[model samples]
Target: MNFLPITKQEMLERGIEQPDFVYVIGDAYVDHPSFGPAIISRLLESRGYSVCMLPQPDWKRKESVQEFGEPRLGFLVSAGNMDSMVNHYTVGKKRRRTDAYSPGGISGLRPDRAAVVYSNLIRQTYKKTPIILGGIEASLRRMAHYDYWSDQVRASVLMDSGGDLISYGMGEHSVLAIAEALAAGIPVNEITYIPGTVYRTKEMDSVYQGVCLPDYQEICRSKEAYARSVALQYENTDPVTGKTLIESYGTKGCIVQNPPAAPLTIQEMDDIYDLPYMRTYHPSYEKMGKIPAIEEIKFSLTSNRGCFGGCSFCALTFHQGRQVQVRSHASILREAENCRRDPEFKGYIHDVGGPTADFRHPSCEKQLSKGVCTNRQCLFPKPCGNLKADHEDYLQLLRKLRELPGIKKVFIRSGIRFDYVTADKDPRFLEEVAMYHVSGQLRVAPEHVSKPVLDAMGKPGHEVYLSFLKQFQTANRKAGKKQYAVPYFMSSHPGCTMKDAVKLAEYVRDLGFMPEQVQDFYPTPATISTCMYYTGLDPRTMKKIYVPRDPREKEMQRALIQYRDPKNYELVKKALELAGRRDLIGYGPKCLIKPGKGEQVSPGMQKKSRKKTIRNVHKKKGR
Candidate 1:
């Protein structure tokens, strides 16, 4: 159960001549399932293949990637769990001071667009060796799509990095298939039939059962085409009903993305989590300080994969899909026992959840066989009548984990789906959560209080959130606990006008909570929200929506969310005035802003301005 080798010295010490794969990663090597590189590397090792990890190699130096020399099969690359662009920059598109995934929580360990950068670096040294790209960065950019940073539609990452192929999505099944093929002496260039992979091909003629997307040039020339293309890609994400998609890049050829690999069975899910993970960062990184990303998940257990919550702003639908595949309770309990034995165990299990904590199975039984609805959402607008809203399994799992010998507490901090919680016919789960699980407070994403904005965000309407809030409070009261519901709110989302921002400010003001943090909508790749932010039309409905593109207006929207702050007073006042609600700019109890100490303009100057307006009207009449 020790870590796979990361250096040539370690490889030789293990009696390995040439490694089977040289794994290049954007993040520091952490042999934990939470890290994508660890999963791929460990899985390869379990199959009797040698893998050497090259973490955060300096793209500037050719010797960095040369450390592993070359591998027998190929080199597998990933940009860690998070997209490098999202890692490097904030929602404001400003450079962040630290990278939590890096050793010492440092910045600049990996360059922006790390997958492409690392892939290109590897190609500089090994021209003919297979280069396989995976993880969030490569997965999201695996086709002709928009780049928020560059503010343009870029070609597939396979094209951008010149990588031989890309293994998208969770990549557990697809990667294994790829590894087997490469080990069997298949050339990387000819191995294009694997599902969940995107590859460049000159002959689209060989592709079957495919939908041809608009050429890159056509999409680039018209936002309409781009939206349509993105919509098509979105529809064909489910493994049960999806088709192979092909998009051209002029004379160079085309990029083909095969249908996603089928969801892992319960046994398979259990097997993946059962891998012998060291469950911590490499020991060699000890001197550099701890990897901050491990702090939350150090004692957490992932109970499931994929989400049916169907958040428009989320990339899970595109990556993990909508089917909920979970591990058996026996597997989770085993992980909990292992947690108890760790030297650092403090009698606390941080979380036991996945993309959404409360979801233990698919929203409905039919989803696994027939696929989720591509056009409509499972929980948004309204929870469907067919919704299998049950929490018996998750509740039982929590109870078992809590009753473990060394466990003092089990917190559900991975984030619970509040909407799902409210949909349950029984309130026992809510009451139990309030009594035991929460760590004094629970965080939920009711992104906003405005219905129109929530609709555009593909979130359940405001009433559902309000209903959930009441239940949360009532449960807390009955449990005699002083628990708080900390709602996460976002500002400047598409369809959020200044009027809506004011309404949100008023709602928070009534609740007597002025949030300290507000997210200005980030236009990350492949999400419906990102598409709307770029094209100014909702991709789901192709309807024009108001976007707060003006930098100052966006600032005002943010300020309005925290209107109580003195620094935001001016911005909030201006926003209120611009929304034609100047009545809200005074010291009334309902007012969002306070009045100034002095008049904005002299009475004489105002009279003169009024007279000049009259004169202009008379002059126009004379003309």
Candidate 2:
């Protein structure tokens, strides 16, 4: 139940000399299952391997990584829970002011491209140590892909980080195999047979029956080739049908990705979460103020892993895969009881779902054995005919939690696929959510109202969202509650046009509400949308798609979402003119904004504008 050793003295106190693994991470060490480093380290500890955490080591000083000295087995490196670049910079490529993962919500604790930087730092001291890369940064960048910040395609992280092996995806199975092999004195070069791992080698002679991707130079030379390679990598993500993939780097070597590890069994998922976790940030961080990241998740329970929703913007398909894996109700309840007993318990459970809440089982029965379809999706384009949209198991789980004596509220904040809800025949799940789970507001992502934009984002059409809203409102009425649906929308996604932006703004104007925050489409690595952003070609269809890359256009599109705000007036006005929608500029009932001083407008329209403005101001004062 103790934290892993972090220093030579702590290692000695634990009666260990040189430990089995030095887990060098890019975050302040938080011993919680929610953090990947904690899960991996605790899993290793449970398997009788000594692990010393090196959280946020000074990358500028090689001696910082020497605190725990060289490990008996190897050094495990990760760029914390998030990709370091994503954490440090906004989607606008502007530097962010705070890092939730760092101590006191401070930025600059971890270096950019942290996995590579930390791995290189370790090499400066322990040149021959078996460095294994894990976590989201290394996992997503395991192969050659586009780097948004660098504005070019980059080589595989395994090549740049100089890591001997990459345990991609949920790494428990591959990591254990790696530890056993290393303990048996197998060299890292010889440990290439493990599933869910990527490695480099000069000898391609041993790579049997593997798919050879376009050479790295070819992809770098051709964006279309890169798109093709992305599609190939995506198809090989399932454990049952996925094949070993090889990416050549000319003479340096070939990077080989073994097929993904099999999804964990229910019992195995239970065992992993049941491992001893202090479930909080390291006590040393107390003086620096609580880690902001923990506040959201401290009371939350992760009931599932993997997603079947198949979101194009999400990197889950590349990391966790599309196969849904869940923990048994008994296991989830055990964790809930632990939370109930905690001193910080407030009779509330923040969340009780994973990638997509309410996905308690695989998308279909066959997925358990045959894996998801390589070329098709379970919930997008339209739900597959075989898609099982049943919510009975999830409903029962929620009901059981509500019946718990000490639990006052059980909420689902991780978001659910509303289209999936609509697909289910039974109406009880939606009814229960509106009645009990929702805390007056249910946040749903309907990304955009434009049909083309929706198709590009792989999200359901606007009509589906509208139907869900009607159903949700009906359920709220039945429960005698005035609940609201807070729809989340994104702007500047690939395939989004100026006209499409206007269409979304009109939809908002009709609703008489403006979203406080808007998400500009961020082109992180390895996502289908990111590929489209960089290549201007849909990786799925290899068709050319319109991408709004100009900074001014991006801002204008964002402004349209909050057109009601005074600050966005000029941008919105300019956007309306550019889209040939100046008709929406005057004081018609459908108009988004009124004309400024000295602007030409009909006398009738001017009178209406004055009346509307007066009503709006009165409404504000009443509030």
Candidate 3:
């Protein structure tokens, strides 16, 4: 019912001499399950351990970390919910105007490389205090990985941050285990044996049966080696089938990653979500303004925690693993009921799913016992034959939420795997979602239309998307609703050529759809797509691929997605020429854009530029 203490006085008011953990985060203090710091702090508090939240502490001064002094056990550092670089800068490496995670939606609140910065800041004040890194930044960067901003392979965050350990992935199980070990007076250096953690050590004698990856220097020297390392890491993501991975940092030390912690059971998932969360930003920020991130999730319910869709561009496989762990219907209903009780409740539940919304259980029953297959995906290339592809449980859950009092609409705002929908034998789930869950337009990610590009992105083919679109329209018509399917597409992905970009633009023109926003491929750390972007080699297959890294080319690819816009006319025209599709640049029905005056057209082209007269010009000017 109460927010965790953020100030020393607040801690003292709660009668704590010193907190068991001082959680230093790079985001504003928002005590919601959606925020990692909130969950860890609340979970610790539930376990009789006091925690003081130190959010967005000033990295310029060491005294900022000295606010609550040293903790009884250690300092937990996280770069909030997102990686600091990604939060601060856009895919084009331009600084963003605002930060959704900061108070008042302001920018420049947290330093770049926040986990490393915050951890170093803490080390300045308390030299010997154990600093344990967590959250997306630390989790994905727990090894020597590619850094897009710097264009170099960086060391493990555990080494750079001077942190004793990294509790990677969804750290509920590992963090709790770490707390118990620390509380038992175990030294931080001796806590390497814990699962779902990474630590550095000089001696590898004790590392039993660990898989030795190429040294940091080796990967830094050879892109092929780096690609090989990424492939190895990808294969060992399954907790049940993973092995202890060790990587040498030359004379500095070797970083060892313990096998991931086992996926949470249904009861454990329920218990974690059931934790008492104030579920909003700290009240002290009433004047500063609202935390923008909370608004999206305040009324939402997280029904599941893992994804098996195996999208190459996504970091879910490395972070949350491939196993899908979900909460019981009762637990989700309880959370939804609480949302309804809030004064801000507007008879709408914003979302009711997790990483992949409709995934209610493990992809296959065998996943519950043996874990997902490392070699093949459940719903990539094609859905595995063993894939259950059931939606009845999820459908029932949605039905119950809709029937709840004071709830007029319960939306599925999260991304749903359309391929999975097509794979299911039962059509009721798609029909019901189109009829009830969609808010006029249902959002889905087709990513790209080109086979080579979609293959590189590890997404379903255009045919699959086409089939789903037909089904969606049919369902909407049957239900007497006029909903639309808003398919999301990405640009500049590896293996995508100007020809492919033109193809996509032609598709957009034919459909008469202009996307308001487009995602340009960003090479964040630890993703298979990022690996391809960096090495020009597919980590999965080691095949050489074409990668577009020039900013201008990337811009043209992005502009192709919104070719209808006036601002993108020049870029779209340029892209069409480069793709050898000059025929698509005139007054023809299939043309992406009309040829402007003075623009040259290829000889024998069906669509050609025409000279505009004085009368035509005056007409355009409304004369």
- On lDDT, the leading prediction is 2
Q: Which stretches of candidate 3 lie over 4 Å from their true place?
A: 602-623
What RMSD, rounded to one decimal, does every model reach? 7.4, 2.8, 2.8
lDDT of 3 by residue, 1-623 (tens): 68888999999999999889999999999988888898888898999999999999989988999989889999999999999999999998999999999989999999999999888888877888888999999999999999999999999998899899999998999999999999999999999888899998998777889999999999999999999999999999989899999999888989999999999999998999999998899998878988999989999999998899999999999999999999999999999988988999999999999999999988998987788898898888999999999999999999999999999999999889999999997889999998888879999999889999999998889999999999999999989999888878899999999999988887888778898879999999899999999999998999999999999999999999999899999998888888888788876567788778877666644323233355578889998
Clashes of each: 0, 0, 0
The candidates, ranked best first by lDDT, are 2, 3, 1
**Distance from true position, residue 132, model 1, in Å?**
0.4
**Which pairs of residues have clashing backbones in candidate 2?**
none
Between prediction 1 and prediction 3, the one with superior TM-score is 3
Q: Report the poorest 10 consecutive residues by lDDT, candidate 1.
A: 599-608
TM-score, model 3 to reference: 0.97
Better of 1 and 2 by TM-score: 2
* Runs of candidate 1 exceeding 4 Å displacement: 600-623
